[model samples]
Each structure stands twice: as structure tokens, then as C-alpha cells.
Target: MKVLVTGGAGFIASWCRRELTARGHSVLVMDHQDRRHQLADGEEFFLGDVRDATAVTEAAAHVDGIIHLAAVLGTQETISNPRPSAETNILGSLNVFEASTQYDLPVVYAGVGNHAFRLVGTGCYTITKSAAEDLARMYNLYREGGRVTIVRPVNAYGPGQSVAKPYGTSKVRKIAPAFACRALTGTDIEVYGDGAQISDCVYVEDVARAFVTALEHTAVHGPTERPVEVGPLESRTVNDIARLVAEYAAKVTGREPVGIVHLPMRPGEVPNAVVKSDTTTLQQIGMTVADFVPLEDGIARTVDYYNTEWLPGYLAA
Candidate 1:
């Protein structure tokens, strides 16, 4: 199958591209970045922005399916520029999904757990993502030969991140590596508010694989079915994540991580949150969570990947 993955150069989408390529499916990664991270040699490439209707229509002409992952993620960033966030997240979905229908292809939009369940201090981030979710559902109908599947995944961490920038900077290169690197440098990892808010984090590789599984099984769409949620069964708190990163840094650098500092949950915060969807939808499609890498274990692996691979690749430049 030929699949076009938007944001193919980004963290989670990069993993998705690799997984699809490994399975011998040709992948055409469409992004404004004009690059695919960790790209498989077999995969194809198309350089364009998701915001451009012509790019999506052109790619949809050749692809069998779509993995829509491009967006302006992060709360601080989204609220800082609400209009861009809205246009990128909401309008981009409309353009891509509309194009997919025109060319007759199934599309899977990457839905975050927070979008369906809680708002938190996410501000416009939640609102914009929610608009896209609604748009996906609105377009979910019996077309000639196209389909829409919404994948609600939890917080994902792995290689291909960018958190090495200065303080108060909004650059998050790689989610897991950024946190782990910060901890190793003895930088205080910031917890938005009270660090008790729970976040379910599946490894990026695992999340990528689940998307494929969801794509393969039509039962996920239920013919009569509507919603699809995919991720691990459990969650960890912000404090829990900080502690795990600290532990990994301690082991790698041989420095003791005393502990995480307590903090407060900001206004409009949604605590004790997890995306709830009908498990039967995914089960019907034969999709189940696999490779439950414990947070600490995933953190340790990510830290090693950063220090050995990512840091050298970037710092040397």
C-alpha cells in the first residue's frame, strides 16, 4: 500500500514512516520540512506544506491511505499563536481529509488523549485539536470508497526530539530526550502545575505500529462503528516522568537524582485525565497495545539514544 504521512519529519510521524517502510509498504512523507527523519531507504518523498491544498490533493492522487500527524503541538506554543494553531490543526485536517475523499483513500488523523478527555493548562492547544476531532467526525461518512479513523494516543516519547535549546525557549526537539537531557544537565525539569496530573505515554515506536494495525483492520471503522482510541492501558504523572528522566540521567552520568520538586496545576487544568474511548472499536479491528515499555526503561533507552546518536549528530553540526 502507498501511504502519505504528513509531518513525516516530526518525532512520532518519523517512527510511523519507518514502521510502514519496514513492512514493505511504500511511504510518501509530505511535510513543509522537505525531510523525513529516520527515513527508510525504500520510502519515497514529497516536499510541500499540509496547509497547501494543492500539495495534499497531489499526494492523495497517488496514495492509498493517509496518516495526518502535522500540527503545531504544545500548549505554550499554541496559545501564544492561536490563529496559526487553529489553521494548522483544524483547517489542515479539512484540506487533507477532503482531498483524501476526492482521491478515494482512508485517512487516520492523530488524536491526542488530552483532546478527547481534558483541557488542562493546554489552553488553545486543546481547543484547536478538538476542532479537528470534530471535523474528522463530521467527515466520517459512507463515501464512495474512503474512510476516516481517529487515533487517540497518549503522550509519546522517543528519539527525534529537540529540547536542548535555552531556558524559556519553546523548542521541544524530542520529547523524551529533551526531558532526559535536561535532567542530566541538572536543569530543573518544569512541571506545569501540581505534578500529579497523569499522562499515558507509549513509546513512539509502539504508537507508530499501532497506527498501522489500525489501518489494516477495517473493523476499527466498524462499517457501523465511529470512534477509535489507541494507546497503552495505563498512565504516569508529570512528576512520575520527571523522576524517571532524573533516574535515567543519574544512571547514565552516575549522578544521584534527589527527587522532583512539587508544583501546582495551572488554571483551566484538567487533572486525573486519560482519553476514554470504546475499547471494542479497536478490539474489533484486532488492534491491541504491545511493547509496554516501563517509563523508566523507555527513558533509559531514550537517554542513551540521545547521548550516543542525537547529540553527536546535532552538536557536531
Candidate 2:
């Protein structure tokens, strides 16, 4: 199959692209970043934004399906600057869905796992993402023979996640990267909201596989009503993750474990957000919780990556 992957230069898209190629499929990547140098033979890259309808339409040509992953990420980032997030997450998604309908193509959309519950009073990221998911459902409902599958992943983390900056246009702070980076440097790990909030952290690789699986299933069996929730069976608290990162960083770097600092919850965030995995959909698509990487193993690998790859560059910078 020839697939057009939006935001293919991003972290999860990078893994998804690799999985696509590994499964003997050709990919056409459309992203704002220039990653043509990374494209393998038979794979192509188009440098463009999904918000541009013409760019999206042009990229949709000659592709059997679409994997829509491009978006303005981060809870605080989207809440701070809601315009761009809405433009990218909502409008860009509309463009993708429109192009899919025009081209008669299947689409596998990337959605936030907590969007189902976070809709009421969450940040712009969740709101926009939820709107985008609704757009997918609408398209699937109205378009004749439309095939759209939504994969909602919970707190995906792995190597190559960016560290949080105190001041930036994109205040994208992820827990795994924040904890791993601080712990590696022997700085205290900060846990927001008394460290009671729970989250389901799914490995990026597993999430990528879930996308491919859903894509294949949608192509063969048409769209499923329930979105595929890609997450581990078990969930962990913010405190559990913080202590785990500290322990792993201490073991890897031979340094003392870092302290865990509690802070008040940030705005536009759900305090008790936890993912309830849709096991029925997972089983229908031939996946099980046992297939997911264990949290300890995934976190250890994440910490090691920050220590070996990210830390040196960070210190040098």
C-alpha cells in the first residue's frame, strides 16, 4: 500500500513510518520539517503544512490511505496559544478528512486517549483533538464507503521526546521527559497535584503498531465505531513514575536518587485522568495487553536514552 502520512517527521510518526516500511508498504510523508534526507528508497517526503488545503490535497494524490498525526501539541502550549492549536488540530484535521473523502481513501487518525473524558473542561489540546475526532466520525458517517479509524494513545513516551523549556513558544512539557531529564542531572523531580493524578503511559513503538494494525483492519473490514484505545492495562500515578525515573537514573548514572517535589496542578489539565482501555476493540484488531511493553522496561529505556543521547547535547547547549 502507498500511504500518505501527515506529520511524518514527528516522534510517533517517525516510528509509524518505520513500521509501515517494515510491513512492505511505501510512504509519502507530509510535514513542515524537511526530513527528505531520512526517507528510504521507495518512500517520499513532501515539505508542507496540513493546514494548507492545497498542500493536503496534493499530498493525498496517489496514496491508498492517510495517517493523520500532525498537530500543535502540549496541554499548556495549546491553552496558552489556542489559535494555532485549533488551526492545526481542528482545521488541519478537517483538511485531511476532506482530502480523504475527495480521494476515496482510508484514514487512521491519531487521537488523545483521554479525549473521551477530557472534553468537558480540559485544555485546548484536548478540545481541539476531540473536535478532530468528531470530524473523523462525521466523515465516516456521511461519506459513502468511508474508512476512518481513530487510534487514541495515552501518554506515549520513548526516546527522542523533547525536554520542557521554561520559556518557549511551545511550552510542551511531557512527564516522562521532564522526570527523566531532571533525574539524570540529579535535580529534583517535580510532581504536580500532590502526585495523585494517574496516567497510562504507552510505548511509542506499541502505539505505532496499533496505528498500523488499525489501518490494516479499516482497509479490510471498514471503520469500527469505537476508537482503538492504545494503552497499557495498568495505570500509574505521577508519584510512581517520578520515583521510577529517579531510581532508574540513579542506577544508570551511579548517582544519588533525585527528590520528588510536589506542586499545585497546572491549569487546563484533568487532575484524575486515567485511560480505560477498550479491550474489545483491541481483541477485534488482534492485540492484547500482553503485547505492550512493561512500564519499568519502557521507562528504563527512556531514561537511558536521555542519559546517553539527550544529556550530552543538553549540557553542551
Candidate 3:
């Protein structure tokens, strides 16, 4: 299959691109950033923004299917600037759905696995993501030949995870790497609020597999067949993650364990929460919670990857 992957340069989308290429599918990666250096042999690249409908339409012309992963992720980024978040997550998604409808293509959309979307007090990130998902559903319902399979993934961490820059800083990374970097430097791992916020963190490889699996299967558009939620059975607290990252970073880099500092929770962020989807959906998709990579092992691999491959450049910079 010839698949078009938006946001192909991102942490999760990069893994999806790898999984797709490894499974003998040709990939057309569209990202504003040139990630051609990351492409496998026979994979193609397109330099454009998802907000540009014309660029998306042109790219849609050649692909058999679409894996829509482009978005302005992170609560801080979205909450700080709702305008760009809405523009990228909602309008950018509309372009993908519209183009897919026009080309009569099947789509696999990336969705969040948080139940916070159902609850009140959700932030702009959740709000925009929900709106985009509604557009996907509308496309499936109203447009002929429009098929979309949604995959809701949990918090993912692994090799190639980017280190987040400070808020309002130039570089932006994820939690796992942020903690890992702090751990390496013997700096305090900042924990917001009581630090009991729970999250289901899956390995990037596992999440990527779920995306490809959904793409391979025909759209199970039944009313109950919602976005297939994919993640490990186990959940971890933010405090636990901080401790583990510091512990592993010490072991990998021969550094001392870092301290943890509790800070007030950010506004509009969910607290003491964990999320997962129905097991029946996974069973129907030939998957099980047991298939997910164990948290300890996944964290170890992530720490090692950052230490060996990513940390040097970060330090140099």
C-alpha cells in the first residue's frame, strides 16, 4: 500500500513511518520539516504544512491510504496559544479529511486515549482534538467512499523521544526525555501538584504497530466500533515515571540519582488520571493488553537510547 503520513517527523509518526516501510508499504511523508534523512529506501517526502489544503490535496492524489497524525500536541502549547492549536489540530485535520473524501481514500486517524475528553474542564488540546475527530466522523458518515479508522493511543515513550524545551523556549520535547535529561544532569525532576497523576505509557514501537494494523484492516465503522484504544495494561503515576527515569538515567550514565520537587499543577490539566479503551475492541483487532511492552523494559530502552544517541547532542547544544 502507498500510504501518506502527515507529521511524519514527529516522535510517534516517525515510528509509524518506520513500521509502515518495514511492512513493505511505500510511504509519502509530509511534514513542514524536511525529514528525508529519516526516510527508508523507496520512501518519499513532501515539504508542506497540513494547514495548506492545496498541498494536502496534491499529496492525496498519489496515495492509497492516509495516516493522519499531524497536530499541535501538548497541553501547555495548546493552552498558551489556542489560536495556532485550533488552526493546526482542527483546520489542519479538516484539510486531511476533505482531501481524503475527495480522493476516495481510507484514513487512519490518530486520537488521544484520554477520558478527559468526556469530562468537563478539558483544555484546548483536548477541545481541538475532539473537534478534529468530529470532522473525521462526519466525513465517514456523509461522504461516499470515505472510510476512517481511528486509533486512540496512550502516552508513548521510547527511543527517539525528543527532549522538551522549556515553556516559551525554542526546542520542545516530551515528558520522558525531559525527565531523562534532568536526571542525567542531577537536576530536580519537577512533579506538578501531588504527583499522583496516572498515565498509560506505551512503547512507540507498539503504538506504531497498532496504527499499521488498523490501516491494514478494513474500516470497522459499526456504531460501537470507536477509535481502537491501544496501550499497555499497566499504568504509572507521574511521580513513578520521574523516579524511574532518574533511576535508569543514573544506571545508564553512571550519574547520581536526581531529586524530585513538587510544583503546583498547571491550569486546565487533568489530575490523578489514567485512561484506556475497551478490551473488546483490541480483541476484535487481534490484539491484547498483554502484547504491549512492559513499562520497566520500555523505560530502560528509552533511557539508554537517549543516553547513547540523543544526550550528547543535547549537551553540546
- On lDDT, the leading prediction is 2
Instruction: In model 3, state the lDDT of residue 93.
Output: 90
- Quote the positional error of residue 120 for candidate 3 in Å: 1.8
Which 10-residue window in model 1 sums to the lowest lDDT?
A: 166-175
Q: Rank the candidates by TM-score, best first.
A: 2, 3, 1
lDDT of 3 at 84: 80
- What lDDT does each candidate get? 0.70, 0.85, 0.80
lDDT of 2 by residue, 21-83 (tens): 999989999989898987877889899999999999899887999999999987766777889
Q: Mind giving the per-residue lDDT tens digits that candidate 1 earns over 1-317?
A: 88889888777887887788788878888878756554577788888888899888998898888888988876555556678778888888888878977976778888766775333355576787777877776666545554777777767777655564652234533346657666766666666667666666777777787677666654235222555665555556767778888877778777787356555654435666543333455665566654456666677788887677655555455
Clashes of each: 10, 0, 2
Which pairs clash (backbone N, Cα, C closer than 3 Å) in model 1? 120-270, 161-173, 161-174, 162-173, 162-174, 163-173, 193-264, 193-265, 194-264, 194-265
Best model number under TM-score: 2
Score candidate 2 by TM-score against the native: 0.95
* TM accuracy, model 3: 0.92
Question: On TM-score, who's better, 2 or 3?
Answer: 2
Please give the range of 10 consecutive residues that has the lowest summed lDDT in model 3.
Answer: 165-174
* lDDT at position 207, candidate 1: 76
- Segments in model 2 whose C-alpha atoms lie over 4 Å from true places: 166-170
